[model samples]
Target: MIALAMVDNFPSSPGIYLMKSAEGSILYIGKARNLKKRVRQYVLGSGDSRLHIRFMVQLVESVEYIVTDTEKEALILENTLIKQHHPKYNINLRDDKTYFSLRMDMKEPYPRLTLVRKVPSDGARYFGPYASATSAKEVLKQLYKVFPLRHYPLATCMARKRPCLYYQIKQCSAPCCGKITAAEYATLAEGAALFLEGKNTEIARIYRAKMNLASQDMRYEDAARYRDLLRAIEVTVERQKMVARGGDSDVFGLYRQGDQVQMAVLHVRGGALTGSRTFLFDWEMETEEGLASFLNEYYDMDTPIPPQILTPLPIPEPAALEELLSEKSGRKVTIAVPQRGPKLEMVKLAEKNAQTAAEERLAKESSSATLLSELADKLHLPAPPRRIECYDISNIQGEMAVGSRVVFIEGKADKSLYRRYRIKGVLQSDDFAMMREVLSRRFRAESDEEKPDLIVVDGGLGQLSVLNAVLEELEVEGVEAAGLAKSRTFRDMESPEISKSDERVFRPGRKNAISLRQNSAPLLLLARIRDEAHRFAVTYHKAVRSKVMVTSELEGVPGIAGKRKKALLVHFGSLKAVKEATVEQLSAAPGMTAKAAKALWEHLHEKQQA
Candidate 1:
């Protein structure tokens, strides 16, 4: 009744709406062309049969809205709110890996191309949001082969006295040592830019002209270089199928089953299929709304937008979306639902890819679910543990001790929740003490709502007892705990007996260790979790140890104090580099005077000699 009253007051204009729970937490966020009409559908339950909508409607206690002059503004506002609040009922897309882009600021005196995740709006030409960092790096490698632009850091190049290996290998123009003039470097940069832009014919023409001029001047070496460049360009064009058949565009295909959705985007550049990106979302919404929300969020201002976008389903408010995209891309943009021809074919291809990816993902998820069920049964857990936290400690003779906590949700690692701790309370190599300290600190930091269903420690009954004591002291209830340890075999001293490997699980209140069957799913899952925790702890321990060693090594030098050590490390990059540096280089480093540099150099060399 209250929801209907709130809907009655909604304005009949395009805007964003927020559905809140009793405690005012946002349950869902949505955008609409007509706020009043949209809100009424949810409040009255008029023809909206989606399972999630029915569920969300039951939780929505109050409603709020922000009126906008246009649907595009509402769309933008909805995306921002969804990200900020992470509404429980919205289709949330969490992509941890950001694609890489090749960025180069042409305004710089000696422009160098570099890979970056974010594209700054500082007049730099950005080439890609490549499918992966490796793909972007491969493109950079190819560019280096054809264009000898500077590849080293600008500061390093400026400070260097001679050309490095890249220059010697003809992969760099060596602007640091003046091997190439500014004008010549600019020409190379332009050629590289054109090549990335898929203007291969223009680049080939320029290379051919350069080859002719070099031959006419009787510079056979230069002519041969240009010939090779032309050949590389020709091969790349043929391989990419860049035949000037189609303009730049992006095709989006969507697949949905129950609450699971998958989206695939195909990027076409210069009539050639360049790359594709796949995204998965787990939520329910109308197809048009889902597609609209995705389109608005995926193509942010910083992301490169193609001139034309093809969608499997027609998006709501095409004109408004087109206008917003045009403003973002700085050109006219079109959003179309193709019915026939090559554009339709591209859409079909994207849909096919999406469907295949969805199937694989579902199969993997089903296997994970089965494994979780099996594990719960083996452990005699009250329910299948959705989130399991594993703890491990790593140290070498009680020095540089560290502990790691790894989280797994439904048999998949949730890396965002993983944590590391320095074993400050325990100075000695006591696994029991280390486990207690780590668990106490971890539970103290996390709220009850964030607690894991199960806690796994790496050890035998001793470690399990420590963890159980800590949990009891903290009064943390409703959580199960266990420890994993390698089984030991006993043999008679006077008689020989066959031996076998045994894996054991130690649980609280159990008089004897639980023996798991060999190659069982539950045993394997627990072993994998324990190994991952150990690996994380060891990695963190090594990093901490390295820092300690570097600090200690620098402190041995008479005049190198903490500040000087930091400055030296920051400038020279490492302790080994500082040790290998000459007196002049050391003096040039920040915070180091000539006298101090000489003294430090002598002290390091003396220590090495001794």
Candidate 2:
């Protein structure tokens, strides 16, 4: 450990300090206004009494610091370093995927609503970074019901001689079949954009005005359509709950039990509760520090920022945070801790939700622990396995073979530890060799991944034997291994109801496969894990297979490298579209030239005619 005297010589200015383990892995990162005083607190043994901090301190072998111009800079730098190194004690984000958003390209001949994960500057209108996928999909579903915009791309549907099912369902006006004029479709697209922006009231007002005008002109059919649209908008708006007086805001509530914290964020847009998000993680720092750090990291995600952010506790340098978020959002932003009134009630509501979420999580974990105990008993294991891994192999005639590994911690999937390996040394359809290769590579001495407490092979006796042999050859010890086999179909002539037997688990050295209760919790959990491994393997296998099949139709075209081929597929949506596109249209694919497009056009035509 570094001497306390070393902290004495450290700079007192605002900066971040990184605590490193003996192996040079950053164990924790912290920011402070006065660096020396903060490090001194840890080194002198008196700054905080949190349990994780004590554990972190025990592992600290050295310290390093970088001075910044101000506390705000220190905060930003601390977030950057923590994200890059993923320190052991930091409250990390649970998901790296950006929230879903709706994109509408007004420039298109017919604009269709599409869900996208990232927000890019493409001159099209974008709405929402919806944290809940269901909420986003529901929004689109409701939008399609109200506004009859095209459901598919213009090029894909324009050739249809008759309107599709969506047109019959009233979800599309069928611009492709000329059921709606270009002018009418433009109005629908504009209305859809406004509705996505949470402007239902505005939509109602405009539709009402149009309804009156249509009636006055004696256009009874048009008036009825406008009346129906207005009614739908009113119903939609009335269903939404108004949580604030005005303006967009995000309110945060937190529940903390020791180092574990569950935080809830309520998204209020246009004065109504639009959606919410919850986060569960461990934090070893003071509540204020954790909240501050979370705010920094959370806002840095491509999530949309609102004008105001309400928190349960005051964050350090609210102005700095506001400035950072404002610069990113291109708006004036404010942060506050409400003391009274409706805003305070909103915070309380968030807290109550957070409490409920935390309680539910605790109960679930408790149930999972019990199930694990039962599972251990079923397997004759010494203790309940805390880290379980299941592996499966996938291939079609040994073509583009792949292996998948899925991990479960405390009966929950830990996606970060999941892996998929491409089979390199195996040939032909030898499942045993595939299993052996996968298990050996997974347990190699240099792998940084943690070894599993239990290894489940997704097959019967042969797979179990392969797993055991690999463990023995690698000299790996203390891991439990089992093979899961599917239920066998049983044809009972007298009893048609008894169609299948229970799924069987094969154990090492056991002649008969043990059958757990078919619908029991332990068996269901195992089935879920096994299914995930199979799905992962199948997905990777398809990707490898597609890469092998993607070579056709474009192989002989000049300037059609891998990236260009992918661009063609993406730009045209499919190879069929690419085949049908004219030379000029083909040239429109990113980075494609007139000469290359012509070559591709002639090549496809020559093949098609031949």
Candidate 3:
């Protein structure tokens, strides 16, 4: 346990503190204006009523602290450390998908717009972190219709003898072939950048003047092109409803159900609702502190920080957070909890989104729980198995043998707990031995508490026997085992005598398999788990096979060393892409000389011809 003496010894200054468990893992991280006072409250068991904190305090073996010049600095450090360590007792944002932004370095001679996940500090203009790649691409498509900026890479464009299809379709200016001068292409690139930045009025003005000048010069085609560009910009602006009513700001709303917390952020850029993001976490901290911490972490340098931030809950130390944001953004920033009017309405809308998201999550969890309960009853289990692990083996002719273990928690796949193993001890296509080896290795490494309540193998009686044998040898107790096997032929509904045993579930010591009801929830759940394990194993096996193929193919080419092969793969994304690349593109790749590129190209095509 953390000693009171250590708490007393903490410095009386603004800083962050880390509560570490006996196993040396960080349990919680917090920032305080006075480190000594904050640590004392937890050590003395006073003013810390949070249930999670009480549990964390019992496990804390030591308290570590770092002093900072100000509370703002301490907040920054706290966010960084929390993200780095991901302490158990703290709320951490974990999202499966990251939004993307459109990026272009305007300084480039013929700038090409591209999609990027992060907004870097390099001198380049960034458009957004659009909710999906499709949305970002849609915007790019619209911009291309108007801007006609260069679309090819610098090397490809410079090396090409003729313009590609994009140029023929007037989607690019073809700066590489000198169809458009560098200065003219730069002007077009700037217009595209301006449109992405939501400066539609300015771009429209430029286009209008160009159109009128072209018309006066008797260039009807040029005038028509400029008119179409101006029209596209105006239509896009109207569709997005871009206006400068409330300036740029972000509104945050939070909802909580027990320990579950959901936050919704609505991004209002130039007074238009651009996009929103939702974050879900399990936290036990006070609402104000949680909101403050989330804001500190969410608005890092890479994320565009607006002038105003509206939160439904009043943040603790709002002034300090505002100061920190202002310092980071190089502008005045306001953190407000609006009580009434339009701003308040925005907060309420955000809150509604958070509540809806939470409800959907709870509904899904409830359904999963119901399915798990049904499955448990059908399997004659004492209770619903919270964790079910299913295993499968995949290989072709004993080559690249691999096994997969997929996990399901309350009937929902818990992919994080899934594991894979290469069949190291077994040779040839013996599924029984492969299953035995995999189970032995897995059970030996897992602790008693981490053991699954039920284990499933992706085969019938043979696989079940292997699983039971391994469990018995390991002396593992209180865990049930079963095997699932697919039926050979499709069921004939026309004949009543036809058995609808699409899936057969086998239990140890049971000579006959249990035929699951056709289209039953329990059967479907088992099928999903078994299929996931099979898919994982097959994917790994294929990856191993592909790597071997790539190695063999690369080895056949003389003078191509491992480093050069790696460079080629990294540049082209795969061996298939490398094979498809032209000699010019191959030569342009890093670590490739002209002669080597030609030789590699010839060798790849030669194999294809053979």
Candidate 4:
């Protein structure tokens, strides 16, 4: 405990303390009302008796503390330190994967508004880390209705010989087709930005003013359009009913017991509930500890930090959290524990939402457990399979062959843990060889760890044999592996509709296969597993095939590499034209080179003749 030795004779001061593991990985970072008392707790092992602490204790090779003037100062320092270090025990909000946001590129001559997962520092106004793709799309849809923003890219708009369908439908201003001036479009775009930023009332008022002017000038059609825009904007805001009673803030509440935790967040943008999101943290942790940990962990990640954060209970280091958040946000941050009023109401609402989410989650988990147990019964396994691994190989006649490994822990997909492997040892068109290679790599990795309960292969007995050989080579014992082979085919008849019983299961080391009765519990389970594997494999295979097709086309273009190829495809709908373009047309394409175009033209022409 280098930190302990340093603190043993040190004077009391409020600051941040970071505990590091033996390898110098941060276990946890914290602040205290009294540094001496807090430091002593760790030295003597007297902090909260939570699972996190126990786990932290195992990793803590040393302790460290920074002294500050007051607890508040310590709070601020702690937030900063925690964000920088991201101690393992903290509940990290920043760890959430980035969701798409609606961005309006404000600096462009004609701002291009679109959905983006990450907000770039290109002078664009971004409006979300929206809960879902659908919600973000809904917002964009509503915004377009209120403002004449073009959804299509500038290139597409410019390339169009005349006004497209969107222009006729009144969905776009069609500046690309010279339907609107730069200055006029700019005014409409600014209003759209304001609307997205939760200034709907002001935007509506501006539209109303424009409508009145148009009416007084006797421009009836223009007045009618502005009137409609104002009404649409108001209607959109009205649909978000909860926004009427709150301020711009976030409400957080947690429902946790043991390692199972559900944290729900309701985002109030411009005083309305824009959306709610629920997060499940499955790692073993204490309830209060997890809440605090999640807060620290989440906010500390490199995500956009909001100004106000409202929680049901006060965080362990509220002051520190606020300061740290303020620094990251580049504005003052308020971490409030509301006792009454809208804040309290918001927390209650959030807690209710959390409770509902938790219940729904528990129900799903229970259902999944039931399904797994039934599946085990159907498969005649010793017990319910805790870890079921599904394998799928994807490729078109063996080109760009890849295999995907999807793991289901108690029925639901653990996507973060899902893996993809490029078939390393096998050349093109060798499915069995590719399967063997993928399984060899996979089992070799798992050979040292506990074997999976079941290995599900998405093919016939040949696929099963590949897995069996890999397991035998690795000497991975006791794990049951099976293949869900395709259903029987009748020569003069159509392919038999594969029912649960139709799925033949080839057990490891067994030459004969058994078909479970369609109604049997085990049959249902096997069918589910087989279908899941098939779905995963097919989706992954299609993705690989698509990528290969795209790359093959780009390969013909002389100057095209990875990035430039992506830019070209993103700009154009297809690579066919890119393969068969004139030099002038190809040069006009985004990220296309004269040499690239000529090379592609020659290649396509040569191939066509050959």
Candidate 5:
């Protein structure tokens, strides 16, 4: 039936409504505190300007709604219908339906901790739809550290001769090795569930009690370990402080303009901000109208129902929506318009962040446009260079010295193409020698897989000279090159001050240099490329240095092979922790046995004797 006709038929009672497009696919799903009053707003036309609704009013092929006993029931039904239908105009809960959830399958003999992207129906407890894959893994890492719950697959847990790598890393308690009882593991799993469900206060109390018991039992070290876990939990909660308001309330803020719109959502549970997400959408409609349309569409999503939602605008069906949302949440939901208070402050903060995000995106676009225009003019090229490459060298007393290449497409940095080189044949911190060695090896291996139109070096006259010599020897041509130099210091007090902001550009075979005005487009472009190159180089150097600092028995102690390393790690958990462990403790580790642990301890102790 037509939308207006269906609206005429709607009863003045709680119900779930469905808006559909011409193709018989649902477009929007919503619950109304009063079906007749909510539906009448569409049919009677309260001078609403939403283009989507206007079109629907003109050609709404069909409309449907299900009556519910209460607004809460309608809310539940609306979310379910929205998930099932996935209408075109709905504010999607999970943008990429392929989302991740931390699953704890409590049904198994040895419960498993697995990462699942899709929800399953196998009676597993699921925890999240984390924003990104990396974020999901980060949560998993924190969960493991907090709980040390086993992550072994069902089959592996059933028939395991030894603990796996996770056990060696101390990330798991080795339940497969029978080191921990099933009942104790189950308790940990239950605690994890409560933690995920926003029950931190209860968990904190329990943890404190356990810590006290361990202390009373003369296990001072174990008590300290519990203290560390408590600190981690506090840090996690504090990191999420921005979203939480110490109350069970939802926050929604939007930044929108005619065709572009972004929404920020904060879900506060048990007085803690547990989740926050941002959503962006493009609608071929006006701004205010789009806000109204989006507001209606968003609340219909099938995520957990919050008791209250704070929004910037008064929605079209405010009373009906409040009632419907309240009913769905199984409580009285107050959809308040905060004039001034902490609530208002939160709303303003969200709006400001959203606006800032939008502005940054626009600024980057403008920067890219300017760079493309300037590069085309300066390089004497037919068009702007699409890809630019810059290089820098990093070292500490010539040990673990490395070179890095950073790429910029148009004007923005592209990290995926960043490459690092280990400096060979360069004995010390000689910038010139390092440049020659790094560049020669780089271009020598160029193929269909790698090449750039422009190359930049983070140096001055000497460094560029070395690079030019390498290019000439290699006979590589048609590529433009430049050197960016930092400002030099002056001795004379009366002379104009030399600022770090001052940068000089050097060109090949040129007598004079180019100096971009501190605030000019070219200066900004060059500085951006230089900073990115420095960042890339420093990151690579740190990685190499960290590896050098890490003392591994296999690499350090003689006669320690693959099997021994595995045994040490699996027995002692972590190398650093193992270093601090007593000889008795090390030997007691499962397969290590007393004799082997004693021998290892004596070998390590020989250093003190020397």
Candidate 6:
């Protein structure tokens, strides 16, 4: 539904549009203060009335735009084109274990707090968007029960000579034995940034004026350690949930059943509710532009931005996304929409916890679509593979061979379509020519990846006849493979019993092996995709046998050949970091040469001067 003479020469300023689809792809990405009155509100459909944007504006076909000289540079180029074109009708929010936070680095000397997950522009103070990594290590285990701070790192507590069981329990101020003072660990890192900025009554009135100045200097054990730091800051602010009596907000909650969306937020902070999260997904558009592109990718500067934001719906350019979340959460943020009291009953308890997190994620995606249709009816296959892929291989008898693969989709594990390979022209212990050179270099690669709808292979019936001779020598058709095996045991020689066997499977024209039933959910999902492709090929064949034992000590040194022995094992990633480097870090590695890094640093210290 594009052509209104293709947005009649667009430019009514502000920008970022995109739409596309009909071969060109990007089916949605938005942002605009005007771009010709928002592509004339989705080409006269008045922008978004959602039937998921009128079936994505009848498959768009073209709308492009860009412009950007402010509407906050078209809200950061529509969040960098919805994170580089993940634009399938917007709202991804897939990244999970929600932004951890906490950090501290007030130019260090003794400042700790820690927990992270990306928040670096390093001036450092941070706090949290925390709702995981066990709520930012349960708020750094209650800010180490009253901020004595320094829980390690000042170069590992200045290589600690002593003082660690968190300074024998007063939860650390050992500052590695100097027991505090860097202005008392910078006043316990300003009372752990005012108890993670919920400002627990100005840090319990500065620990009640340091427990009444350590009880007027009589110092009864520093006035009972400031009366146990105001009773552990009033028992962690009496375990949260107040929901009011103060401010720092963040409510937002919307739920949808069609186009499956969820949303939820809650948080509240000083006014308490303390945590809620929810996001769920499948959105197609207009819940005020998916809660305004989820509050501009959930307030990015690694998340925590609550001066206020309580939406139910008002979005589009809400004052230029409150000036881009008040310039990346430095503060003054607001987005409200209330309409009654108790902030619309905490946005209807974040839309009843986003409709109980979208009916517990559609009953865990309808029990992973009935365990992928009972594993496509016990692997007779045709449909429920829902992108499987497995492989395996590893190597020790073959010396550093590799393999791996892994993936699984509808029934879960998708380590970003895992993969691995490396057995270069099978030189030895042939596990069927190293599983036919890792399944013919993963089905003769011309990669954009996504192909598998089932391929698993670990072993049995000679690894399903080397994956049916590498998919009948890569004429590779719609995939479907199987092999599995593992479960052996035996032992009975008269009264000393043992016996084991059940795992099996096999398939490709099955000449046997099918067993199953020992704890079957399709044999525990084909033994969890053959033990995650044998733990991703024995963690990449123990990192290629420790870089082939550091390329056999750079093939007995001299000029250290093979491209400076693979550029000093890819720049010193061990032979004990190239035998503790330095012949000027092996002549600054990459294909070395200060006379071959002083003959491989004098042949790696000539076997430590024998």
Cα RMSD (angstroms) for every candidate in the order listed: 4.3, 3.5, 4.6, 4.6, 12.0, 24.9
TM-score for each prediction? 0.84, 0.88, 0.81, 0.82, 0.49, 0.33
Model 2 worst lDDT run, 10 consecutive residues: 152-161
Superposed by TM-score, candidate 3 places the C-alpha of residue 482 at a distance from the truth, in angstroms, of 3.0
**Local accuracy by lDDT, each model:** 0.84, 0.86, 0.84, 0.73, 0.71, 0.77
What is candidate 3's TM-score against the reference?
A: 0.81
TM-score of 5: 0.49
Q: What is the lDDT of candidate 1?
A: 0.84
Question: Best candidate per lDDT, number?
Answer: 2
Tens digits of per-residue lDDT for model 1, 177-290:
998889778878989998888888888888889889989999998799888888877877777754225678988998888877899999887677878988888666678877
Model 2 lDDT tens row, 1-610: 7689888999989899999999999988988889998898887778677677777788899999999998878878988888788998887783655678889999989889888877665788888868867889989888888998887766557535588899999998998888887877887888888887777777777788889998999999989998998888878877877778877789999999887899999988778887888888888777887898898888877677888999998976677778777877777989999999989999998998899999999999899999999999998988999999999999989878999999999999999889999999998998889988999998898887777889998989999999999999988889999999988887878886758777989999899988798899888988999999999999999988877776776896888888899888877767777887888888877889999999999999999999
Q: In every candidate, how many clashes are there?
A: 0, 0, 0, 20, 3, 1
Model 5 Cα lDDT, one tens digit per residue, 1-610:
3546656777888887776667777766666777778667766766456676677555556678889987656656766776677666554454533445678878877666677766544667776645567887887788888878877554334345678788888778788788778876786777787777677888788778879999999989768977887887777767764444555676778887655787777666666655567767765434544554555456554344556777776654466557665655466877766778878877787787677777777787787887777865764445666778899999998888999988988777787788899998988878678878888878884555456677889988777788788888988776678888877765556767653446788878775567566667766787789988998899999988876664444365544556776766665555654565677666665566676666677766675467
lDDT of 2: 0.86
For model 3, the superposed segments whose C-alpha errors exceed 4 Å read 1-12, 17-28, 35-65, 80-88, 94-98, 131-192, 233-244, 300-304, 326-333, 422-427, 446-449, 487-501, 572-588, 605-610
Predictions ranked by TM-score, top down? 2, 1, 4, 3, 5, 6
- Model 4 TM: 0.82
Which candidate achieves the best TM-score against the true structure? 2
Error of 4 at 467 (Å): 2.1
The lowest-lDDT stretch of 10 consecutive residues in candidate 3 is 91-100
Clashing pairs in 6: 41-47
Model 3, 441-492: lDDT tens per residue? 8888455548899998988898899999999999998899989998775557
Task: Report lDDT (Cα) of residue 596, candidate 3.
Answer: 94
